[model samples]
Target: MRAVIFGASGLLGRSVVCAFNDMAVTGTCFSRTAGGLVTVDATSADDIERLLSRDQPDVVVNCVGERRPEVWAETPAQARGRNVEAARLIAEGACRYGVRLLHISSDYVFDGKAAPYRPDSLPNPLNAYGRWKLLAEHAVRAACPDAAILRLPVLYGSAQFAAETNLTKIARQVSAGVPMEMDDVCVRYPTHADEAAEVCRRLAGALLRGQRQGAVAHWGAEQGLTKYQMAQLIARRFSLSAGHIRAGEADAASGDRPVDCRLDCHDLPAALGPLRRWLFHTEFPPVVEPWLLPARPVSS
Candidate 1:
């Protein structure tokens, strides 16, 4: 199958690309080292249309969107342009080209007051990031009904951690003996990019085979943990003291954010015949410790 992945240089996108390595995969990187790959600005509709038309892919995976809460808050318009408008263009191009679209969404679509959100749960986002993502979902659905939307939780991997504060990022801080404070108030189901990538490939394949994923399908671990818990796990993994990492809450000082956005794992299991989970997440701080360790030169 011919597949085109937007924002392929990012962690989740890269993972998806790796998952579909056997297939003909084309990637879109923005302002990052292309390494002999296609580079496209995700926010530009003309660029997106040209690429989609040029490739005429059998499947298009959108991993491009504004994920930073700060960016969403600071520049709401730009965030919407990147996250929502960009999605609209992609869906349009997909519909025009008669291709399946697998867009990566976020758990932040919920208000977080709820503990576990089902795929059909009504989304009432508290922050701008969530709001924009929800809008993007709507735009995609409107443009392409068969588009499979996969709502994910916070993702972490060796490929991309500098932009987001995932387990590995916090682990790096603790590894360096740098004290860190994690938000305990915001409950989340942290997912590894590899896990999400697997699900993406499965769903995309299903979609290509004429199986619809309904309006949306969520893929995440059942267990939910806070940033504090992740930090503690990291500390234990590296044999560092967890005391330095204290519990935190994102109050007014931290800007608007939901308290919890743990997604229900039932829909994925029901639709996709049992959701696949990462052993690293369940066994965290250990199964993933080696990957989080600082990189060094290999001996000749």
Candidate 2:
């Protein structure tokens, strides 16, 4: 089967591309084109239509979005275009072409007050980024009712840059022995991109088999951790000194982040076999090792 993956150059998108390696896959990126990724304007209807028609893909997976909440606050219009408009156009195109769509969403749709949110839980986004994602979800559902929406938590994996993902950013800081004041207030399920990608692959397979259409699912690591805890874990795995890392309150400048957005992924495993599990200590070291800064020499 043929598949089209939008934002294929991104952290999650890259893994999604690899997950569907068995299929005829066409990957598109707005910028940062590499690995033969086609650059296309996802917001443009003509661009979406042309690519859809040309590829005639059996499934369209949209991993496109403006992930940073700060960026959304800084440039609402641009973020909206990428996060909302792009999704709507892609879903509409998928519907028009009678193709299955798998849209990636975020756990940010729910407020942190609630623990372990379900797919059917009412979304009360606290920040601009979450708000836009929720809007995008609506757009996708409206245009393509059969679209499968998979909501994921904060993701980390092999990224082009350490700063591209939150966990990698912390890993970089830990590697450098840089003093960090990490937030201990908020709880996050730090899921790896590969894990999410595998879930997407299974969901796509299910959709191809004409099952779970119009299903909204949540997939995330069961382990809940704070940024401070993540830093400690990274340091432990790398044998780096976490002495410089100290637990602190959440940064106000980081925007209105949820206290706990841990998702209830029981439904996902129930619907699609067992969910992929990874031990943070075992799985993360190799992924972040390549991007780590060299240790500085100690003064005599």
C-alpha lDDT of all candidate models, in order: 0.78, 0.90
Worst 10 residues of 2 by lDDT: 249-258
Q: Tell me the TM-score of model 1.
A: 0.89
Off by over 4 Å in 2: 252-255
Model 1's C-alpha root-mean-square deviation from the true structure amounts to 4.3
CA lDDT, candidate 1, residue 60: 92
Give model 2's TM-score versus the native structure. 0.96
> For model 1, how does the per-residue alpha-carbon lDDT over 1-300 read when each residue is reduced to its tens digit?
899999788878888999988689999898676666698877777898889888889999999987775777788888888888889888888889999899989988887776678889999987778888999999999999889999998887654444354666667666555566668767667777888999998888889888864459877766677777777777665666667676878442365677777887676666667656786544565435654556434589
Clashes of each: 1, 0
Q: Total clashes, candidate 2? A: 0
TM-score per model over all chains: 0.89, 0.96
Find the candidate with the highest TM-score and give its number. Answer: 2
